[model samples]
Target chain A: MKTIFIGAGNVAWHLAMLFFKNKNVQITHIWSRNKENAELLKDKLDKNIEIYHSLDSLDFSKTDADLAILSIADGAFESVLSKLILPKNCILAHTSGAQPMEILKLANYNSIKNIGVFYPLQTFSKAKEVDFSSIPFCIEANNKEIEEKLTSLANQFSQKVFQVSSKDRSILHVAAVFVCNFSNYLWTISETILKEKNLPFDMMKPLLEETLQKALEINPSNAQTGPAIRNDEKVIEKHLNMIEEMNLNSNFSRIYKLMTESIQQK
Target chain B: MKTIFIGAGNVAWHLAMLFFKNKNVQITHIWSRNKENAELLKDKLDKNIEIYHSLDSLDFSKTDADLAILSIADGAFESVLSKLILPKNCILAHTSGAQPMEILKLANYNSIKNIGVFYPLQTFSKAKEVDFSSIPFCIEANNKEIEEKLTSLANQFSQKVFQVSSKDRSILHVAAVFVCNFSNYLWTISETILKEKNLPFDMMKPLLEETLQKALEINPSNAQTGPAIRNDEKVIEKHLNMIEEMNLNSNFSRIYKLMTESIQQK
Candidate 1:
């Protein structure tokens, strides 16, 4: 598979490097809104790969690349698509969890036949190494042929791949926010609270890890514990009072109360 | 050191087992309001150990127990302490994150010389095996003598032990709820949302693990990601709409909004 990579952010950097390592995939070109970022990504790959400063400047006719993977921000999808021109038969795919595969149809070159989504359902950081084999790849395409192509390509790197719809992909993205983003925010809050008391946040690490492991082993709902689930009103009241007394962010009290009620309601 | 174990709940079960395993510590007596539970706990240890149905029946004077560990519920503390009698020299302690060591002063046996707190900062499920070596043991006492005794006892099983104050211990408890209990609830919400879409929750495991690993390595505030941190109103609105469209729990939308606002404010 000959591919052109767009975007030089975390997701793009990881995916481009993965593609470069796979013997079956050849990353022939790279592009990003920021030329320096594009150069940075190019530096990580074979030196022969061409770097394009703008989507329009890339001559799709010259490379014969079979696929173009756009790993840009969700807000950039429409604008990037509107300006991007691709070969009539080349596959165009966006690696976004929130955006629909049909969004790829907005590419300026209307004749482009295969537009799809190659969404890798995992958090990525350029500085951290990711084990791609276990990450779920949510693949969606305009038709069976495109779907098979994308799934086959994804299978080369990941053991888990699914033909998830745009609607379900969006739903998964929301769930991801809750589990990954929101839970992380809660962890940040815990760290802040511990810091205020001159306590090391490290004290919570074992419990945090055990909570996650237990939640995975037994469904999370069944693994619930603490004052909220136990309905220990006295402890809850004490905590609320402590939050107020400490003059911590009002959100701390609010979240504590809301989460407690939610847990009890469940 | 000879010890008397009180309560038969999760905390009591784990602590008794740990004390039983340590060659330096001998669990001479066990008591719980529920005789059946006390018997069950006793069965897990040497058959020679005594099980008392009531705290009043446990002759602390005869047992030569230097340490009496109360692992009962917070609500039971006052009632238990009001009726409990301990030897003058026995160290009386309670293993609770929310309760203060001073609460042990309520013991009817006023001559008791030592009162302290032995709070293992981790969640325990009776069936789950815990690694005591890494668990943070937060010890608090009325004086230095009792502090060293409690610290030395805790050190028998755990490498991490701290002389935390009652005030700081309660603060740590609140923080523990956010990081462990509350975060697990968010994970439960994610599982529910994914289940509604006929998607396997397994798809989220890698991302959830990575999110936690990242938060621990980098400060969680710095590890924050997704629409909230990006301040991407479009994606946030889309997620909120989808949550409503799915007719999911009302708390889902409320939490999503609150957590998003909190992340952005941070």
Candidate 2:
């Protein structure tokens, strides 16, 4: 199996690396807006690798790929899809959990016959390394052929693979935002709170690890503690008084109230 | 120092075991509304250990030499604080992040000038064992003498101790809700999404653990990922369509947008 990667961000870079590691698979081409990033894969792998700075310069038929994989931002997927000119039978795949395959079935998919999604349901950072085997890849397709090909590709990189419906993937992405992105936002808030107190976040890390570790061992509903669930109005009142020491007002207050109300629902 | 543990929930149970393990301290009493829970602690420790459903059963003045530490829920803390009868000049403390020392003021002092907090900032589940040594215990007091006494008590359980202001501890508790409780809520949502998709959440656990592990090594702002932060509207639209299929309304939808907007702000 041969793959041509699009984009050079965290997912692109990591996915590209995984493809390079597979003995049977060949990573034939990579294209990114930043030439530096585009060459990153070419420089790290075999010297004969093809690098394209823009989709316009590429001859899709000559790229010699079984698939053209999109690993760019969600907003950018359409632009690349609109401009791509691939062989009639080549598979066009994007690694986005939130994007459904119907988006690829537009009137513009002139030459490409097979289109699908190869979304990985996890957060990825460029500086940090990802173990592809550990990440869940959500694969989807408009037809069985594309689905089978994408499933095979996904299996090469990870043992955890699923042919999730677009509806399920969309809901999964929403839930992913809550679990991965929004949760990180909460961590950001925690770090800021600790910083204002002249307290290092390191002190809270072990507590943070234990918090996650506990949830892994028990249901989150069972793991819940703190003023909100306990309905410690006195303590909640005290904490609010202290937070007023800061000059900022944000949706944070609304979030706290809403979540508290939610926790209290039971 | 000989001590009396005033509750036997997750926190108290884990703590009693730790204190019992330490050669320096003895847990003389464990109070629990659940007699079985109290008996379980007694079963695991010295047979002479006293189990009480209420503080009224123990004449606190003659009970122990060092301290009477309360580790119940917040609403229960003040009631026990008001009712406890203790030795003159003995340290009386409660393990709560948000409660102020003033609750133990002139009423329950027993002529003992010492009163404080020995709060471990983490979530605890009864079924899951916790490594108390790594958990950070925040200590606050009415005065330096109480601070010293509470610090010694905290040191018996955890190596990391901080002399935090009640203001800081309260803020820390608020922050703890974000990092611990809110994080677990995210996991719950993830599990819900997976259940809807007929996918195993076990597939996502390794990634979830990796997400948390990376969080400890890097700031969450830098660790941010997903379609929203990447500003991938096509992907977002696709996910939205999927959500409609699942019949989930706009509550989580608004949260998705709100959190995405917040992530972009970072």
Candidate 3:
């Protein structure tokens, strides 16, 4: 399969590298609004993959690729989609958890024959390596043929593939926010609190690791602990008072109070 | 070194097992309110370790032990300390992160000569085996001699031992809540959301593993992502509308809004 990547960001960079390494698939073109960014991604792989500075320059009539992947930002989806010119048989897919598949169809309703979603339900960082086999790929398409084609493509990288509807994927994205992004913000707050006292953030390493391990092993509801879940009002009050004394910011106290109340509600 | 354990809870059980395995130290006695609970802890190790149903039953006068550890609940610390009568030369330590060492001294100021704090900064579960070498031990004592003695004891189990003051440990405890307990609650909420959509919680494994790895690798503030930190109001609005549409408890929506606002403020 020959594929054209529509973005040169983290997701596109990772996917392009994956496809380039797999003998069965080939990355033909890499596109980004910035020429330097496109070249950076292209430089990571073989010289055979073409780099494009603008989507307007690509003539669908001149390309042999039929699989075009839009791995751009969610906000840029519609704007980038409007500028795209693809072969009539091209299978167009966007790698977004929150965006719906209908947007792809609505963008070029008359011109495009295939529209799908190839969302990888995992956080991506360009500096780190990802084991694609463990990452879950949520695939969706307008038709059975496209669904099977996308599933087959997903199977090359991951064994965990599901045909999730747009609605379910959106819900999954929200849940992912709570687990990945919001939880990360909690770590940031932890770092801030520890830094205020000149304590090392590394002190929380073992606890952080064991917390995740326990959650994976048991239901998180059963795995809950600490002052909030324990209903130790004294400790909670003391912590709040200390936070008040520190005068770092109000969000720390707010988060502590709200989460405590939420846990108690459960 | 002969040590007497004053509780048979999760922390005590794990600590007792660690002491029993080490050739340098000996667990002289295990005490719990319920006789059966004490016996259960003793059953996991050698029978030579005596079990006590009450602190008053075995006279501290008859014991050759100089190190008595109070591994009981934070709420019971004062009550347990008030009842204890130890030799003048013995060192007394309580494993609590929030409680101050002064509380231990205040309970029986004239009766006790040495007071200290030995806080193992990790969550413990009875069924799980923890690697003692990696767990951080926060040591505190009233005198330098006792502090060094406690540090030597802690070094037997872990290389990561630090002399933390009561105020700093209290702050560390609060920081720990954000990283461990509060983060675990986030996972619980995530599980609840995914379960509502008939999605497997296992789908979040890769993301959870990577989230922790990234946090440990760099500053979490630099590692922040998703709609919240990205300030993607469109996706955030979509998520809030979906939560409302699901008619799930309003807590989900509230958390979404507050966390998003908090991230934007950062």
Highest lDDT among the candidates is held by which one? 1
Task: Tell me the tens digit of each residue's lDDT in model 3 across B1-266.
Answer: 78888888878888889888888888888778868879998898878988877757534646878888888777677667777766667788888789998888745566578899999998877766788898889999999999999999999999899999998899899999999999999999899888888888888888999998988887687788898776788999999998888886778788888888998999
User: In model 1, how large is the Cα lDDT of residue A115?
Assistant: 87
Among residues 3 or more apart in sequence or in different chains, the pairs in candidate 2 whose N, CA or C atoms overlap within 3 Å are A74-B232, A75-B232, A167-B242, B89-B112
| Candidate scoring better on DockQ of 1 and 3 | 1
Candidate 2 local lDDT, A1-266, one digit each (tens): 77888888888887888788888778888888778988876787778777888758555765557888887776676667777777767788888776677877642476777889998877778678877786788889879988998899789888888888887776666666666777777788778777777777787788778877776777454677767777877766665666566644465665666665656654
Q: How far is candidate 3 from the true structure (C-alpha RMSD, Å)?
A: 2.2
Decide which is better by TM-score, 2 or 3: 3
Which pairs clash in the backbone of model 3? none
Report how far off residue B257 is in candidate 3 (Å). 1.6
Give the poorly placed runs of model 1, Cα more than 4 Å off: A53-62, B52-62
True contacts kept of each: 0.76, 0.65, 0.71
Shift of residue A228 alpha carbon in model 2, Å = 1.5
Worst 10 residues of 3 chain B by lDDT: B53-62
What number of backbone clashes does candidate 1 have, counting pairs of residues 3 or more apart or in separate chains? Answer: 0
Ranking by lDDT: 1, 3, 2
Each model's DockQ? 0.75, 0.61, 0.73
